[model samples]
Target: MILTKQHLQNNFAKARETNSPYVFVGIKAEGVSEVIVIPKKSFDAKEQFYMNAYSEDLTHVMNNNVMITGLSYGDADQIPNII
Candidate 1:
C-alpha cells in the first residue's frame, strides 16, 4: 500500500509498541521518487534506508562498503554516522 507521513508515523508507533522493525516500500505522488525501508537501529532508519538506497547506484558500489546504521523517527540527517 502507499504510505503517507501519517501512515509511516502510525506504523512506527506500532513498531515501537511491538519492539519490531517496520519495513516497506513507498513511491511518492510525483512517481519519480521512490523509497525502501529496512531494519536499522533507529526509527528514522526508514528514511536513511531510503536515502542510502536512493543516493547511489548499488550496481557500482561495493556491498561491504555500505553500512546499515540505526533509524531515527525524526529526520534522516539527524542521525549520527558511526563506523
Candidate 2:
C-alpha cells in the first residue's frame, strides 16, 4: 500500500505515544529526504550521531534542511517539500 501523509501522521501519533523514533523516507528534488521523528529523549543521541557523520562537505545541504512538527493528519498539503 502506498504510504500517504495521513499514514505518516498516524505513525507519528503512535510514536509520540510510545516514545519511539518515527522514520520515513520521502522523495525530494535533490535526493531522498529521510525524516526521523524522535522524541526529545531520543533526539539527543540521534542528533549527535548524525551531526558527527554528516559534518563534512554536506554542511550547506544540511543547513537547508526543513523540519516540520505539530502537523495534523491533513496538513500534508502544507509540506511542499514532500513529493
Number of the predicted model whose lDDT against the real structure is largest: 1
Give TM-scores for every candidate, taking all chains together and pairing residue i with residue i: 0.35, 0.31
Error of 2 at 46 (Å): 16
Residue 69: error of model 2 in Å? 17
lDDT of 1 by residue, 1-83 (tens): 32234444565666566666544443332224334454536567654444445423221123434322322333333233210
The weakest ten consecutive residues by lDDT in model 2 span 66-75
Q: List the residue pairs that clash in candidate 2.
A: none
Total colliding residue pairs, candidate 1? 10
- For model 2, residues 1-83, the per-residue Cα lDDT tens digits are 44334544454555456555433324322444543344445544644454453323223335435322222212234234343
- The whole-model lDDT of each prediction reads 0.41, 0.39
